[model samples]
Target chain A: MIPYLACVLLFLIGLYVVISKRNLIKIVIGFSLIEYAVNLFFALVGFKKGALAPIITQPEQVRMGVARNFVDPVPQALVLTAIVIGLSTTALMLSLAMRLYEKYKTFDISEIRRLKG
Target chain B: MEGRILPLFVAIPLAGAFLVPLLSKLWTRFADLIASITSALLLGVSVYGWLMVNAGGMPLHYWVGGWRIIGIAMWFDALTALIVLIINIVGFCASVYSIRYLDRYTGGRWKFFTLLLLLIAGLNGLAISGDLFNMFVFIEISAIASYALVAFGTEEEEVEAAFKYMVLGEVGGAVLLFGIALIYARASTLNLAHLSQVLAGFGRTPFYWFVIATLLIGFAIKMGMEPFHAWLADAHFSAPAPISAMLSGVFIKVTGVYAMSRLMFNVFGVSRAETPAFFNLLIAFGAVSMVLGGLLAYTQNDYKRLLAYSSISQIGYILVALGIGNFWGIAGALFHILAHALGKGTLFLASGSVERQTGTRNLEQLKGLEKTMPATTWSHILASFSMAGLPPFAGFFSKLFIIIGAIAARMYWLAFLAALFSAVTLGYLTKVVNMAFFVKQNSSVTSTREAPGLMVLAMLVLVVLTVAVGVGFRGVLDHLVGPAARVLLNGLEYARLVLGG
Candidate 1:
């Protein structure tokens, strides 16, 4: 319960940085933080306190109800996929930030206001 | 139902995305050729799939790697067919248009075409995705490609808009994933069919509402709803014309409106009777967006900017119809999706042509385009009429049905508002015509002739489709729109359809 709340807190802090920060690189970092928080939450979702690895090397061990105690592997797999996606996107965002800095000669988002809302 | 062809929807475009760049290294022209051929092939497959589903052999399912529930599932039904068809149609037109239309931009044609294919692949996969996590991944694939494409020009304004768009779109993707995660935790399954069956008994718990709200907010942002639309106008305005057309015409519908409607109605099993507040929230969002988008569009002087706002207004119209949640309402929503895609697509493509020829999109500076750029002007005239809901155009029937649906739902004021916005759409769309096409030339900025033959041909294709759909409104309504709406209207029956498959 505490860990879930902590994950939510991390997500909110990341979102806050995205909303409040003025630096473009910081904004990219903020996005990464949000994604990492979500990935962490996903990984934690499948964790059981005393669970064994989700592998059955012995068929007799599987018959001892060991399968039920095995940690669910789905969320871990999901987290792996999520981390790769997060890495690529964060890299893309950072490259864009580099280009924006070259264009504007500053890292401040407030300076990159050519397109209006 | 035969299911072997289902994977081709993703495979063709995914393969084309890589092939375009590799083939382009040998020759640049091959990029255009490969992209056009790929989109045309996808369009053909979508047509065949539409026919197959329309023949009542629908709700086909394919388990990737034949792993059944453990592997990724691809489900094809009326709704998937409808969206895939729309994506490929606009995609085909956009690809053809881009062949000549891209001359103005400075990028290699290969890069643009590759990203375009990637975007299309993601949308197609999103439409057929039977797993919530896969949908999220496809959403990211499309979002990532679009972010790059939006910045394809690498100009100052384009970069800024792309960054803004990227930030918002990525956040929306995260929010959507969070919702998907919550659902997975609760139902202990990722398959949408399985989730639907399991969640059907959960009722409206606080957690359920929380997840639904998070997902709705995520999609609403993607759809460019009135309140969450800060990124839309800028992104649409900054994107190149073909990208503009794709973004305004199909991207918003596919990523935002279609995804939201499918989830709310099917997986969550929301109904008007059982969840009046859910429906009402949608109605409120629709009402605000229509009024605000129309009023804001009327004030824009930039041609692309106005069309961007008008896209928002038209999206509002579709949302209102869906929110009504009646038979006529659902059908009207589906039809409006088609009508708006064709009409708005031509309008953006025409705007691109005008900008390409004159080197300006400022409505204040350009005039007498009907004399110099007849093809583009006529495309503008026809698509604007359709968008304005004028008679003998495709947009009219959609507006009529939405009004009827609103009336059926006993929402008299909302019905009146829908009618009023039709007129409002006409007023703003006419502003484009009067300023750009009808006004006499004070200067010879209109020196250029028609857009390139292929661009004109692409615009003509969409214009013809709009007119053909309007003329063949009955057949489309009976065949395409009807089944799509029924699938959505039946809500939880989607579970039976897929799980049974």
Candidate 2:
């Protein structure tokens, strides 16, 4: 329960960084942090006490087994997809940051005010 | 055979998108022909689907890997039908417009066509997918394609705008995925129909409310609703003009407004007694976006940027209408979605022509275009009046329905505010028309000839539709918007259709 609360706190911190930080790279990092926290939360949801990975090997053992210990594979699968999406988004954002740096020569979003009202 | 056509709407575009680059190597012009043919086919399929669904009297669901609940499914109903028609029609028009507009961008025509096709496929897939996870995949596909298109120019400003768009959009996606995971964790299902069934019996809890809030915020960002709309103006202004029309006219509507309506009304059962707060929250958000976006547009100098802000404002009106949560409001929202897409798309395409001819998009530099390019000027005038909600124009009736709906819901203040914002919208658009067409033309632009014939023709068709819809407003309201509204107002009927009574 405490760990779950900690995950929520971490997510809030990341959100704060994303909303308050002015540096483009920092904002990206903040986004990554939020994603990591969510991924962790999803994995936690699937965790079971003394649970083993859900894999079937050895027909004899599987026949005798009571199936008391198997982690939820669905959340794991979901997290895997989330991680891939996060990686692609991060890479794309970083490249865009590089381009922005070349154009503005500054990482500060305040200086990127050529568009605001 | 019925289900077969459902998948074609998505599959054709997906196939065309993947084949374009490969075909481009063999024949340089292959991409253009393939894309045009694919969109025209999609338009035909969507119209056919609409007719079949109207006659058949229920949404169509197609199972991807056979008729099992666990396999992927595509559901088509009145709502999806309306959205699919909007997407394919605007998509066809934009693809046609892009044939010439994209010539301005040197090289990478193949890449541009590929991305545009992929975006269309994503939107179509998003509209029809019956499962939550599949919706996420389609949303990403669309988002990634749009990010690339926003930076298509590869200019410094374009890259910067794309960067901002990516950062905000990625955050929204992440938030949405997290919400989806939470919902799945609680309900133990990813199919929207199954999830809603499980959720209905779960009773109200803080956890469910938390998930609802997260989903709403995430989707709201995509919709370009207020407080999360910072990225929209930049992305819309930086993309190529036809792409801008796609983003503002259809993409935001599909991924944002349509998704929100589905989740709130159909999936979450926000009409339940305990969820009145959620409805109020939506109304408040809609009001903010309406007032703020209009005020922001009044201050813009750049032509595309002004249109971008106006897109935000117009979407606000739709949100407000939907937020009212009545038959009339829902109908008005749907009508506004179609009306805004046609009006704004024509204006954006015209902006492209104006930019190409004068080589500038600044309002101060672009004056008396009516004399210079009469056809483009007339299209712009017609679209502008429509946008400002003037009488005898499509925008006017849509806004009227929204206001009347608001009043019927006993939200008199909101109705008055919506009307006031219409006037504010008129103020900004009138300024644009006066400065760009009515004022004296700068010496440099005086010699500029009319836009290309194809561009003029495209704008004329949209103008005609805008006028026709306005003139025949009652008929459209009776047939299209009214039926779509009935689907939402009768949300339980949706569950009956999906779950089979």
Candidate 3:
């Protein structure tokens, strides 16, 4: 319960940074932070306190109803996929920021406001 | 049902995406030929799929690797067919336009085609995926490609706009994933069919409402709803014209509106008797988007920016129809989706042509183009009439259906406001025509030719579609829109079909 709340807090902090920060790199970091928090929360949802690995290498454990004590592996797989997507997108965002810096000579987002909203 | 054809939608585009770059290295013109051929092929496949489904064989599902519940599932129902038709037909036109239209941009054409194919692959995947997590990954694929496409110019404004769009899009994606995580934790499954069955008995508790709200907000931001639309105008204005057309035409509908409508009506059962508030929320959002988008669009000087805001307004009409949640309402929503895709797609392509010829999108700078660019001007005239809900155009019938749907639902004020905004759309568009065409040629203007033959051909195809859909809407309504709406109206039936009941 506490870990879930902490994950939500992390997500909120990232949201705040994205909303309040002016630096382009900081904004990208904020997005990464949100991704990590969601990934963490997802993993937490599938975690069991005293669970064994989901693998079934032994016949004995299979007979002992080991599936009951096995942690959910699907969330871990999902988290891995999410992390890779996050990494690639963050890389793209950073490269775009580098180009923006080249064109505008600044990292501050407020200074990069050529297209009016 | 022809189950095998489902995967071809994703595979063909993915193959084309990679093949274009490799082929481009060997021959320069092959990229154009291959990209056009690929989109045309996808268009053919989508039409064939629609014909197959319309012939009484539908709700076909395929399990990847034959893994049943363990592997990802893809389904091609009426709703999927409708969206696939929209994506591919518009995609085909955009690809055709881009072949010649891209000569103005500095980016490599091969890279553009590759990214475009990847985006189409993602959209096709999203439209057909039977699982929630698979949808998220597809959304990411399309989002990433679009982010890069937005910054394809590498100009300062383009980069800035792309960054802004990316930041908001990422947040929306995260929130969307969070909602999916919550749903997964509650149901202990990721398959949308399985989850729908589980959620059927779960009832509308506080957690369910929370999940619905989260998903709604996430997709709203993605679709550029009125309150969350800060990034839309900027991104649309900054991207190249073909990309702009794609963004405004199909991207918002596929990723945002269609996804949200499917989830709310099917997976979550928002159309159930207990969920009056859900419909009310949609109505409220629709009202806001309609009024605000129209009012704001009336003030824009940039041609593409104005169209982007009009997209938001037009989307509001579709949402209001969907929110009504009646037969005609759902059908109207579907019709509006197709109508807007053709009308706005043509308009944006024409705007791209105008920008290409004049080298500026500013209304103040571009004047009397009808004399020089007749094809573009006529295309503009047709699109504007359709967009403004004028008689005998495609936009008119769709908007009329929405108004009638609202009236049938006894939402008199909503119907009236929808009519009023149709006028607002006309008023602002008249300003566009007045300044860009009717006014005398500007002093700095030079002789301009029609947009390249292929570009004009693409725009003409959409214009013809706009007219054909308007005149032949009775056949369209009976065959396509009716079935798609039935899919939404019979949400529980979807669960039953997918779960083999």
Candidate 4:
């Protein structure tokens, strides 16, 4: 329960930073934070107390309550994909930020004024 | 002819994307050859897929790695066929246009083709996937590629716009993932067919409704609907011409609108219910987008920005038709998607030509282009007229059907508003023609010429499609649009077809 609340709080913090931050790099960090929060939530959702890893060593294990005693593996697999996608997005944003800094000579998003919308 | 053809749509582009850079190292121009050939082959296969669906009168579902009911699969129905056809055909034309238009940007043809191929692969994958998580994965692939493509120019405004688009787009993606997570936790299944069956039996709760809203809003940002359209105009205007055409023409529809419709009508069973609130939310957003987008476009001096805003407005029309939530409404929406793809593709490609030829995008400076660039001028006029909902053009019939659908749904005022803003569409577009083409040439400019042969060829192909779809819309309606709409209208049949009764 506490972990779930922490995850939601982390997500809100990221959202707040994204909305309020003036610097481009800070905003990028905010995006990463949001992604981490979501990944955490997915992981938490699939949690099982005292559960073993979702690996079966023998056919007898499958016949017993082995599956029930193991944690759900789907969300972990999902988070792996999410993390990679988040990394790509972060890398691209950082590169764009570097380019923006080169062109505009500032890290402040508000200062880089070209397009109105 | 088999379910096997679906993966080829993704495989061909993926191969070309990776191969282009290595091959370009061997021969610099080989990138162009490979990209065009790859897209053309995709287009051929998509057309064949369309015909196969039409002939067989059922979906072709392919299970990957022979994973029966529980694993991921590719589902190609009439609806998927329509979107796949749009993506590949427009993709081919854009690649053809890019082969020359990319000359201005140095040393990145390989990178450009690589990202473009990835984008095409992602759109194709998104269109045909049979599961929710797979759809999200494909959306990320396309969104990430598009973010890079948006910033590929690496200019000041380009980078800024790309950053803005990425942030908002990433937020949308995260929200979408959260929604999917919520659905997964509750429904305990990821497959669309199985999920639908479970959801249909699982009574609606507030949590379910929350999930629905989250998904809708997330995709709204993606589609650039009225409230969440801040990133669209900037990104569209900043990207290069071919990229701009692809983004405004088909990318938004495939990722945002098509994904939303698929989830809502097919997986979530919105089409089965009257769904007044859902319908009203769509109508409200649609009407606001149409009116606001038109008015804002009227004030824009930038050519591409104007086109981008008009996209928001036109997307509003599609949403309005969809909100009507009837057969003709959805069919009209589908028809409008094709029509706008062709018309807007022509406009963006033509704008690219104009920009390349005159070295200016200012309407004030681009005067009397019609006198010098007759081919481009005529094509632009035809596409602009079609987009403005003029008679005997594609946009007209689609708009007509939408208005009729609204009226049939007893939304008389919404229909009236659609018609009113359509006139506004005509007004702004005419403003474009008068300022950019009809006025006498600016005395300061001396070296305006017709666009390159490839650019003209691409524009002409789009213009021909615009005219053809409009001229022969009756047959289009019967063969393509009707079946596609039926796929949405008959929601339970989708489940039964996929998972058996």
Candidate 5:
């Protein structure tokens, strides 16, 4: 329960950084932190006490409390997909940040106001 | 055979996208021809699907690997059918327009078409997929393709805009995924039908409310709902013309609006008791976006930027209508989606032509184009009038239905505000007409000529569609929009349709 609370705290921290940070790179890091927190939450949801990996090797072993031992594999699978998507998004965002740096010679989003009301 | 053809809607585009780069190595024109043919074929299939759904009640669901429940399921209902029509129709026209318009861009026609095809595949897949996680996957596919397309020009501004779009869009995607995860944890299923059944049985809990909140925020950001709409204008402005048409016309609607509506109405079951709060929130957001987008558009010199802001406003009407949550309200929302898709698409393509000829999109720098480019001028006038809700045009019917829906719901003030915003919409569109067509030419635009024949043909087709929908609106309301609206009006009916008796 405490770990779950900590995970929520971490997510809030990342959200704060993303909203408050001015530097483009820092903002990206903030986003990454939030992503990590979500990923952690997903993994935690699938956790079980004294659980083995969800592998079916032997019928005899399965008969011996297998259901009680194996953690849920579905959320882990989902988190894996989420991680790949996050990697792609982060890489694309960082490359764009690099390009923005080249154009404006700065990383502050406020300074990058070629577009505004 | 019915099920077999359904997968082809996605498969053909996916295969074409994969083969594009290889084909481009052989010949430059090969990529264009392949994409054009693929989209054209998809357009025909979507129309067929529309007719099939209209003639036959209920949706068509196809299960991959035979009829196993665990395998992939693609369900096409009236709502999905409506969105599919929008996607394939706009996609076909955009591909035709791109043939000539894209010549201005740099290399790899194959890559461009590949991305376009992938985007189309993603959208069709999202529209049909019955599973929540599958929808997310397809949404990512479309979002990534759009991000690449936005940066296709590789100009400084294009790259910057694409970057900003990626950052915000990625956050929205993450939020969506997180929401999905939470729902999965509670419901222990990802199939939308199954999940909704479980949720209905469990009733609304605090956890359910949390999931709903997260999902709404995530989808709202993607839809460019007010307050979360910062990325829309820049991304639309930076993307190429045909891509702009797709982005503004179909993509946002599929990923954002359609997904939101499906979730809220069908999956979550926003009943009459709960709907008032939902409607109020939607109206508040919609009104703000309507007024804000129009006011912002009036100050824009760049034509595409102005159009982009205008799209934000136009989309707000759909949201407002959906919020009203009545039979006529939903009918108006769906009708408005169709009308806006046609009208805004025409305007974007027309702006492209004017830019291609005049070598600029600045309103102040473009003038007296009616004599110089009669086709573009006429298309602009027709589309702009339709957008402003002029009588005997598609937009007029949609706006009228929405107002009627508001009145039916006894939201007199909301109806009045919608009418007020319609006038504001008229004001901006009239300004566009006077500056681009009626006024004296700026010295810079002396060398401008009419757009290419193919581009003009595309715009004309959209104009014709707009007119057809306007004049033949009763048929549309009876056959297409009514059935679709019924699906939303009775949310419990969706569960029965999907899960069987």
Candidate 6:
């Protein structure tokens, strides 16, 4: 329960930073924070108390409730994909930030003022 | 339903994206050859898929690796077929246009073909894939490609718009991912078909409604609907012209509209009977976008930016039709998707041709083009007429159907607004026609060149489609959009069709 609330809090915090920050790099950091919060939520959703890793050594383990004891791997798999996407987008964001710096000579988004309407 | 053809919608483009860079290294023409062939093949497959769906065996399911529940499912029905067809047709035209369109750009022009193919693959997968998480992956795939393409010029403004687009788009993606996570946690199934079946028994609690709202807001940003539309005009105006066409034509439709419709209707079984608030909200949002977008479009000096706003307005029409929540309403929405795709594709490609020829997008500067670029001018005029809801053009039929739909739903004022906006649409569009084409300030500009052969041909193809679909709208609505709209109308039956049959 606490972790879930924390996830929501972190998401809100990241969104706040993204909206409020003027520095382009800080905005990218906010993006990464938002992604991490979602990934954490997905990870938390899959976690179970005393759950075993989802590896079956033999068929008899299924009858012994090993499957029940196993944490749901689906969300973990989903988070893996989400994290990779997050990384790629963050990398692209940082690179674009770099290019923005080269062109505008500032890390401040407020200063880079070319595109309007 | 035929099972073998589902993967080819994605495979051909993905393979083409892989092969184009290699082939371009050998010879630049090979890149064009391969990209056009790939998109042509995709268009062919989409048509074939439509035929198969139309033949009555539908809600086709292809189980990946033959795994029933765990492996990803590729689902297709009338809705999927329609969206896929739009994606491919626009893709084919854009690839053909790109052949001549890339002549002005320097530095590894072959890279553009690769990104374009990648974008198509992303759209194709987004439309066809049944797993919600996989759809997110495809969203990223196409979206990242678009981000790069939007910044392809790497000029100061292009990179800035691309960065802005990426930030907003990635945030929307995160929100969507969060929603998908909540859904997966509750439903325990990622397959949309199976989730629909399972969710049939669940009560609509606040949590359920929250999930719906999150998904709605996420896609709203993607589609650039109303309040969340800040990134659209910037991104559309900043991208190169052909890329602009693809972005405005089908990307938002597939990413935002198609995805939202699929989830809300098929998976969640949203209905006017049950979710009046949701449908009403959709209607309200649509109306706001229609009026506001039209007004904003009228104010823009850049022709592409104006077209971008007009895209928003047209998207509003589709949403309002969807909100009508009746057969004609949904059918109209489906029809408008195609109509706007053709109409907007021609207009944007024409803008590209003009930009290429005169090297300017300012309406004030472009003068007396009707004589110089006759093919482009006529095609642009015809497309603008269609967009302005003139008769014997596809836009008129779509607008007519939507007005009929609103009347059928007893929403008289909404119906009136629909008609009124047609004139408002014409009012702003003619500003472009008059300022850009009819202003006879220069005989010297008449000495300027026409667009190269293929670019004009591309615009002609879309213009022809607009006229053809308009003239043959009855057959179109009956054969294609009717089934697609029915799938949305009988939303829960989608589950039965997919899981039972």
What TM-score would every model get versus the actual structure?
0.98, 0.94, 0.97, 0.97, 0.96, 0.97
Total backbone collisions for each predicted model:
0, 0, 0, 0, 0, 0
CA shift at B310, candidate 2, in angstroms?
Answer: 1.2
Model 2, chain A: how large is the TM-score? 0.89
Per-residue error for A53 in candidate 1, Å, reads 3.0
Candidate 6 per-residue lDDT, tens place, A63-106, comes to 77654578998898889988888988999899999999999999
Candidate 1 fraction of reference contacts recovered: 0.61
Specify the poorest-scoring 10-residue window by lDDT in model 2 chain B. Answer: B439-448
List model 2 lDDT by residue over B159-248, tens digit each: 888988887887889789879878977887777777777888887799889989999888988988999898999999999998998999
Q: Which lDDT value does model 3 have at B353? A: 92
Task: Identify the CAPRI category of the predicted complex in candidate 6.
Answer: high
Query: Per-prediction RMSD in angstroms?
Result: 1.6, 2.3, 1.8, 1.7, 2.1, 1.7
DockQ of each: 0.75, 0.55, 0.84, 0.82, 0.56, 0.86
Instruction: Give per-residue lDDT, candidate 4, residue B472.
Output: 92
lDDT measured at residue B428 in model 3 versus the true structure, 0 to 100 = 90
Better of 2 and 3 by DockQ: 3
Between which residue pairs do clashes occur in model 2? none
lDDT of each residue in B3-106, candidate 1, tens digit only: 77899999999999999878888888999999999999999999998888888666678999988887898988988888999999999999999999899976
Task: Answer with 3 or 5, whichever has the higher lDDT.
Answer: 3
What residue pairs clash in candidate 3, if any at all?
A: none
Residue B255 lDDT, candidate 4, scale 0-100: 93
For the candidates in turn, chain A alone yields TM-scores of 0.88, 0.89, 0.88, 0.88, 0.87, 0.88
Between candidates 2 and 5, the one scoring higher on DockQ is: 5
For the second chain, the TM-scores of the candidates in order are 0.98, 0.97, 0.98, 0.98, 0.98, 0.98
Number of the candidate with higher lDDT, 1 or 4: 1
Give me candidate 2's TM-score against the actual structure.
0.94
What digit string (tens of lDDT, one per residue) describes model 5 on residues A3-107?
778877887888888889999999899889889988898888888888888888888766785454688998888899888888887887788788889889999
